[model samples]
Target: MSRRILRGFSRDEFVSCRERAGFPSRADLARAADISVGAVYAWETGSATPQVDTLLKVAAVMGVSISDLVVVAENDRHLGDLRVFAGLTQPQLAKAVGMSTTALGALERAEVARLRPDVAAKLAEALDRTVGEIEAAYERTRKRPPGVAS
Candidate 1:
């Protein structure tokens, strides 16, 4: 059987999602997303990206549409706005969602590659957000240039 590799979320999109969720510190988001701190740092810094499954899990946790979290374009600016509206720190958010600071950090950085469905659901509840909202955010941010995938 041939295994196919799935694409991950972009750094900007990851940061945007976190910001939208109220600027939760990397640790807090990682805990909420049930990922590693390294992963979150990687995602936020644009050093790496999360797998599709992981993105979905993150979206659920942030209570936004997956699309909102995945889409990465120069035009998209609502992510930053969302962060201010939510007004949350990474560590605080992670604690609320029952995750370690390290784990939350990974989520913020987009280091996580995948996540279980249950974890995603828990994150959503903790953040007082919805899966659909997360998914939508992902979609909005995923819009690439006419000729580029990234």
Candidate 2:
């Protein structure tokens, strides 16, 4: 049977939080939440949206509320939210992604800077997001209003 794709919390957002939270694998998440690995993968990939009970379990593991996990709109992109939902301190995420906490802070705060390709890849892997997602986030940072402090 084909899986349904729902329009709620973005799969990318879910994946990013899972990675940042240091979930070793989908199986690990499944074990933690008492769900199937396939279900976890499907949820992370947008193939399937979890039911309320499962969503609650996932939120509990990720340290976020159901509202925080839902991505109702395109502009709902917030890396900080993902970081916080993952229950990771900036330093922890920075160390995982092989970047200095200062640089990570700049990225989080939208202090735009050209990222090295390798670093970008590392960030993508560590965040469980595509490189394009990271690039886009940084690009948005660059286009922020001039009066805004990065």
Best by TM-score: 2
Tens digits of per-residue lDDT, candidate 1, 1-150, equal 111122334577767778889756999888988988888898788777665556567777888765565543433422221222243444555687688766755544334554445655655565555655443433443442453322
Per-residue C-alpha lDDT of model 2 across residues 37-67, encoded as one tens digit per residue? 9998877777777754467678789776766
User: CA lDDT of each candidate?
Assistant: 0.55, 0.66
TM-score, each model? 0.43, 0.47
**Model 1 lDDT at residue 89:** 46
Best by lDDT: 2
Clashes of each: 60, 1
Q: Candidate 2: what lDDT? A: 0.66
- Candidate 2 runs further than 4 Å off: 1-82, 85-87, 146-150
Find the number of clashing residue pairs for candidate 1.
60
| Candidate 2 total steric clashes | 1
